[model samples]
Target: MQPIPAKLAALAQQENLHFLLAVESGSRAWGFASPDSDYDVRALYIRPSAHYLAIDEGKDTFEFIEDEWFDVGAWDIRKALRLLRKSNAVLLEWLRSPVVYAADSAFVRDLNTLAPQYAQAAPLLHHYRGIARNALGAMDLHGEIRLKKWFYVLRPLLAARWAVQRGGIPPMTLAELMADLPPAAVAEIRDLVALKSGQAENYRHRLSASLIALTKTLAAEVAALTAPAPPAPATAPLDALFRTTLQRVYPC
Candidate 1:
């Protein structure tokens, strides 16, 4: 198999994209990958200037699956910036992911500087709360759940808690989120992670009473949160960045 970076480079060439950034955007990046976890690679790319000016612009996103082990997706730069303006948590997490496979340093740095300005309390809290609630809803009546679902629920709940307490974009990894958790809870989560690392994706485990209780408690705390949706940030900066990036990447 080709190395991931080489594969990504080839993909960019095929699509005629300037791949600006690529990173592990799923379990591996979140620090909870099982032995068989697929590399969920995501990227941001820029098209030639003419693509944006065309009356009928094509798809702004790309996706490909390479066997069962590599799942790749990318968003065009304009689409990414548009989503970023709305405080898209997924995009924010991608930028913060520690397992970057490739990057244009200037682009990443500029985007990172601009991202925090657009990240507001209400949307981020809402995003994480929804994910946690949905994951919790997947549990059976007896609290039998996939081993992976535990991390699914816990990570988002912790991230929601972090947004409320920390007032900025939360760290992408579970280990970082665990810092605010109680020692007992943290220890339990560590054991769970260890178990998950050896298990397959569909492995099932009965949710422990303590974990169930913690889940409920965190859910309530998150549910109780109320923040006014702040007004959107000015788009002038994003507009300028987009123009500058286009000029830089596709200059005549």
Candidate 2:
């Protein structure tokens, strides 16, 4: 681990937050980082057993930004497990991210084993649809658009399509989604990505008509599809894992 990851780990421990999983979760993880991309570190942590026994529930999330380049946030294990059972797409992506900073081996192993069992198309599709819709809605006026925003919209649109057609989470990277895109759209997007790669953040470009049309059509199609029923995950297993983790991290 580099200094950034090491510092993040130390900060978590200093707060008595035992991190079970930590990984990259944004543009960098998605394989389209620009020259000035920020580090978006997402992690899952657990408090001491005593903290869990408190009369009042405390904050379930922690956020720290040491500088413009380093932004780290985490969810407590209890909150994470609850969200996982509900097929929260963000948590699903966290588990799927390829860049791991620090992780408890057994905890990650168990989480991966449980990920597929709880995978559901409906909530995930709904989630992606919302993401795509927001990104599209936020587009700048008169064909001018942030190149990165195109990816923000396109990825979720593709993810929604993947959920509906393939019945699972989509690949985490934009390059992986190219095969399913129209030839023109893919080419345009790749060029925009290359352009963005050489530039700093806040880069914008005139939207190609073809790319705009492709995004609008895909968004419409994804929005029209019926969301499938979420899978009924077995609660006992998740419950057991939660207890086991608490015990392991705060043994007497």
Candidate 3:
């Protein structure tokens, strides 16, 4: 964690950007990181006010990937807000991530407040289902499967279930999403997590019949769900927040 905070700070300085929020957006944040898992740091930043005013808007993203261990990325605040308006799953997860590397408290607070208002169940359900389908597709149901990849399929299947049943944004952590599962399913998932924690990312093992069964059940249930599309939220509030953030970060 020491290296990460310093790295993020250096990134902020190097890019001359004001970081509004930064957090672990991958396995570490989701509470299921293997011993060798790398940091997936994601952030939202504000460029100099003049950059926004220029006729040619500069790049809105920053990415730094060092080897296979440290991966850091940031989205300019304006770009983040536009995605937020459409309830982007990645942005939604970032706002709820358990591990924070950096933050402007007020900005993060305001953004979280506005998140639920814009989040629509249908899109999020679709997003999670797609993730599960893709991950599941990569595995061999009758043969050996990448053990770690099981989580990739399970997490989103459970998230889709959570979103459909709860009618809201799903919790970011897998443990939270498992709270309401039947005992057998929970036990199987726990065993898988324990095995995954000590193993390398490419570890392979026979797929658990029960776990795969549960995955198929949950996937079918999510696919069958029909949530009404939520009404579009007005952008006035987001616009105000954007303006206010600029003023707060760069008072003139």
Candidate 4:
């Protein structure tokens, strides 16, 4: 479980990937996992200088999948930021994950310094809203409420709350986000999680009508978060973060 980061780092280097940033971002990062949950590993890497000289852009990203057992991918910073600006929550999860296996310590340390500069509320709100809607729909339609669907709904809502509190991107883990909510809210989340424990993989659980109602309210909360437009047409920060971080961390 723990050595994955090192293995990923080694993979990147051996493949001549200009590895920059790496961290735990999936079930392991989230804290509570089904005994059978797959390890989801994600990272960002770049190409060598020669590859950059070519006419074609390097592969935009890399993907490796192993059934439902493991998934590891690397995104070009551009791809990442586009998703981030569109409210990609996974990126936030990586930034906030407590279980760090590997990191360009200084690279992450520096990125942390700049996180707030680009942490706008509007994009994140829109992102969370969409995410909650999708999860809530599953809960509403499934009749048998999926034990996992609630977490999907809960994670985004907590993320929205975190974004609101910090005026920056929020961590995605249920536990980390709880600290930003009221004590009562924290208790509520814990109870719900415990109630759903046997459900990690069941994908079917019953949500009380009250639970459905709460999920709806989360949608409204997502709507409340909105961002001001950038001064000019601009790219999502994911690219710059990737390029600079990679160059900085993996010097030629």
Clashing pairs in 4: 77-238, 77-239, 78-239, 81-238, 122-226, 122-227, 145-205
**What does candidate 4's lDDT look like per residue over 155-212, in tens digits?**
7786775676566677667887778556866676677666555445665667666555
Clashing pairs in 3: none
Ranking the candidates on lDDT from highest down gives 1, 3, 2, 4
TM-score for each predicted model, relative to the true structure: 0.96, 0.92, 0.96, 0.79
Order of the predicted models by TM-score, top scorer first: 1, 3, 2, 4
Per-model lDDT = 0.89, 0.84, 0.85, 0.65
Could you say which candidate leads in lDDT? Answer: 1
CA lDDT, candidate 4, residue 32: 55
Per residue, candidate 2 scores C-alpha lDDT tens digits across 1-252 of 257668876887689888899899999988778999989999999888888888999889999888888888999988998998998899999988889888999899998888877878899898999999898888753577777887889889988888878876677888886777778777778888788899877887787667767877898899897765875777898899999988888885
Give, for candidate 3, the lowest lDDT window spanning 10 residues: 207-216
Which is the winner by lDDT between candidate 3 and candidate 4?
3
Runs with alpha carbons beyond 4 Å of true place in candidate 4: 77-89, 180-185, 195-200, 208-210, 230-252
For 14-59, candidate 1 gives per-residue lDDT tens digits of 9899888999988999988899899999999999988888789778
Q: Model 2: how far is 73 from its true place, Å?
A: 0.9
Give the clashing residue pairs of candidate 1, or none.
Answer: none
